[model samples]
Target: LGVRNLIQGLGEALPFADDTFDRVTMGYALRHVADLHALFAEYRRVLKPGGEVLLLEITRPERALPRALLKFYMKGVVPAVTRLFRHSSEAQELMRYYWDTIEQCVPPSTILAAMAEAGLHQAQRRIVLGIFSEYCGAEAGTDR
Candidate 1:
């Protein structure tokens, strides 16, 4: 866990040079990105050839039961836990904000398309428990 360089930078305009990294990961922040394509572009730009990209996000499930359960957890349980343990209104508000964004976010297909358009081939979405989405893709390697 020794990360030497962790720069605070925007996803749309990453501060690193081209091909600076071999792997790029965005966790639970896809819903907050204003432009998915631009963010993916920056990710691709900074990644070395054949570099991996992993996006862990809260996706809206298609079915009724799963969606309902997710909503209940996000809107009800998360805030309650935060309010009780953390005793922070701001943390509760942040969780509420996360739920709102996930509720309104674009579908997984659209996000996959954006990754493809950004030159990330082999884009795939692996959903867990019907709600958690793990999006994985990679840049074309020199062998390709």
Candidate 2:
């Protein structure tokens, strides 16, 4: 884990010049963004041609049973287990927030469209258990 230049910046208004990085990744924060389109566009602007953007998010399942099961696991089991490992209730609150965001987040199609509109091509979403999702996109005009 010898990573250099670990920097933090606002998603909506990235403090970087054009084509600065080869790749960008957003994890579990897309739901918190006010404008998905704008955030995607910003990601594109900072990425070099052929660069990739990866987004990791929790998504709502299509089926009712999976949804109910996920809710039970996240809201009930996860928090309860977290309470055992950590003394603070903040972990439980964080889990609740994650579940709420996943429950209320926009559809995966919308996110893909935003990536495409932001000049990213080959955008695709891989969903696991109808819950965890990995959204990946490459910059347009790239042979990658």
How well is each residue in 1-144 modelled by candidate 1, as lDDT tens digits?
899987898999999899989999989888888999999988999999989999999888888988898899999999999999999999999898878898997899999999999989899999888788999999986432
RMSD of each: 2.2, 2.6
Model 2 residue 32 distance off true place after TM-score fit, in angstroms: 1.3
Q: Using Cα atoms with residue i matched to residue i, what is each candidate's TM-score against the true structure?
A: 0.88, 0.88
* lDDT by residue (tens digit), candidate 2, 12-112: 78999988888999888888888988898899888998889999998889899989998999899999999999966998899888789888898999999
Candidate 2 has what TM-score?
Answer: 0.88
Candidate 2 residue pairs in backbone clash: none
User: Highest lDDT: which candidate?
Assistant: 1
lDDT over C-alpha atoms for residue 102 of model 1: 88
Which portions of model 2 miss their true places by more than 4 Å?
Answer: 2-6, 142-144
